[model samples]
Target: MHDPATLELLRAGKLEILGRIVEASNATLLCSVELDGVTGHCVYKPVQGERPLWDFPDGTLAGREVASYLVSAASGWGVVPPTVLRDGPFGSGMVQLWIDTPAASISDDEDSGAGSGSAAGSGSAAHREHVEQVSDLVELCPPGAVPQGWMPILRAQDYSGEMVVLAHADHPGLRRMAVLDVVLNNADRKGGHVLAGLDGGVYGVDHGICLHSEPKLRTVLWGWAGEPIGDEAVEMLSKLASLLEGELADQLDEHLTIAEVQALRTRVRRLLATRVMPEPSGMRPAIPWPAF
Candidate 1:
């Protein structure tokens, strides 16, 4: 899907550039176009390596997004689905099915706490409790270690605290997303990636820059730290473990090396042990600062 010719035409045509949202790492847009008289809408992601300097072996940012979608769809995460890219004038271009819905993001507040520098000076017991909570969240990560997965993607207002809902607590999807992040070694799943449709189904987006065999974990949901791995989480972990030796690997083979697959297997095994959360390392110390 990393064809240069197709991409040039799409770039030149500027097909459906409206409603473009600029992310910290890439640009997302709700695009509409007519392909052979068939009208459709798709999300276009043009690579913008403003931070961490996009180092993946491919063309612009679109390819990475497509890769992420491929990996996720293969693993049954049901993230963005990858459409077939084909021959064109500029190079091969990508075409993906566009999903429309009301989406939400997980990020930090600009008003106070953590990133505001108050976290370091607060000496109250309440502050200490918060600090401990933060520490526990870092520890809750899967052991495989994703450097960017260490950041918290959700704020207190983003959860329910009763049953893992928005503005409440850690939903199962949040944990599942975490699992995907750890397995894929995803580093850019911010609040915005977790989108909730009007129908109440939450979907995750933007998975480019994944499949690394390193500790690239980073996110903004630290509320569940120190919380024991619930039965639900364990079941999901087991499901993921089983996937490693089957269809999941076959799907990953396209973009990921065998070493990457093995590394994923190792992460599954390490996370399989109940009651143990991933300890902080690599980029775990960085707080989610709402870049997009």
Candidate 2:
């Protein structure tokens, strides 16, 4: 599931806080971890910093984050990055490997490119290309102008009351993420959580509010709703179902309640039996608010 070396580094490395990710609802720190001459940046969310949620248990968001990573890894999709629950400068926390997206790297280099006219022009073009790359994954567009091959998830009026649609590219990686979200019972699969990594991986992060014992599958990835689950996903689901019966179940129990673990198994089996992407239930809102 995880590269053993990286996992050990996350578990044992000295964490030096680089900055705080204030945008997160919880106290999320961006830190650089070093161990055995190795160094890498990671996001660390200490349990003591978690905001209380009425639905989920207090002080358990960090474990839930790790649990989600476990499920993703066991599913063989690795949609989530390597995450571990460990002691940090603040306290016990969830530490996850930071993935670099194209846009982030471009912004980091903006100052260097500003010095020369030719370099600035090239940088502008590169920035545009990276923006388009991100837009391809998820975007808001005029209701009548959904991109070719993109799936529309919602049609709503913006602040100006103008009609717009939320959609995402019809991509296999995103399809896998959608399926993974269903399994996690993810309550917040916002557009910003779906990252297009510079290394060409589609990753999902911010999984602190997942794996509830109830059906809370809010997401912006409803393009494949009601469609048949593809063969690859079905095969993976079969493997996941098997994993739930043994060691995987044991590992999850450390971070989740017995009820939650059982619920996860049930969800996987249901998906395998139906072989279809689930439609949103009318009982609750199907997408998370502030979708971006």
Candidate 3:
């Protein structure tokens, strides 16, 4: 829902904010947004003053998330809807529909450690609670277990509720989007990021860090890391490649570069090749301090 007057209202903060939502990891602003036509109450993340986060400029995280959602949609994946990106009293910020799903673990096994798909950095009680809650929301596969990076459910925020565990990463469409998240280097796939919609459709949210050529492919859904890319996945990527110059391409072109798309394809190629897992080149072997 893109409305000029409504956007103006939001810009002025004239649109009354309901309550004080929790601060996000990246943005410094106290984030609570208005939901015009999108859906439920949304969480708006505004950029802070001069010195925001060290990685990007103020409002950069929200803008990047908006851009990531756009690209993911172009790839034919279902991600959270980023309605507006305005530069008003809040400077440059984005507004997205706030979803309501409990913080639960989608992992089949016990919560051994933090998930790999976590973007930014994983230490929030919200994320941990999400993993824990998902344990009961959805059913799991008795024989299969998800790898750390390839968490089946990706959420943006954290809540306290029953978690919806999946039946092994069996759904083709779901896994396809998971692959896209990895290639795009989506960092914040907290349990709340993966929303269950009206018609049993799962939606991804919080993608401020996406469409980069850098090897920032951090995620909790790594179950397939050591697995070979099946033929079906190859076909999907092929279709995505073909659409690179079509409608999807147009949308992605605005936020990403040609090289970035190529890199996405490259990731697909690697996944489809053999069973070689991607190793992190992080300076520290493990998640550094300040992660907890």
TM-scores, each model vs. reference: 0.58, 0.90, 0.57
Q: Once superposed on the true structure, which residue ranges of model 2 sit more than 4 Å away at CA?
A: 106-136
lDDT (CA) for every model shown?
A: 0.49, 0.86, 0.47
Residue 34, model 1: lDDT of: 47
RMSD of 2: 5.1
Q: List model 1 lDDT by residue over 76-117, tens digit each.
A: 656454444433223344445443332222122311221112
Give stretches of model 1 more than 4 Å off: 1-19, 27-29, 33-39, 46-64, 74-168, 282-284
Order of all candidates by TM-score, from best down to worst?
Answer: 2, 1, 3
lDDT of 3: 0.47
Model 1 misses residue 127 by how many Å?
Answer: 38
Model 3 lDDT at residue 259: 76
Q: What is candidate 2's CA lDDT for residue 24?
A: 91
- Give per-residue CA lDDT, model 2, range 1-292, as digits (tens): 2578878888898888978988899999988778877667779999999999999999999999999999999988989999999999999999998766654443332222111122222446666565456535888999789988888888899999999999999988899999999999999999989987655568899999999999899999999999999899999999999999999999999999999999999999999999999998999989998898
> What C-alpha lDDT, on a 0 to 100 scale, does residue 150 get in candidate 3?
35
In candidate 2, how many Å is residue 225 off? 0.4
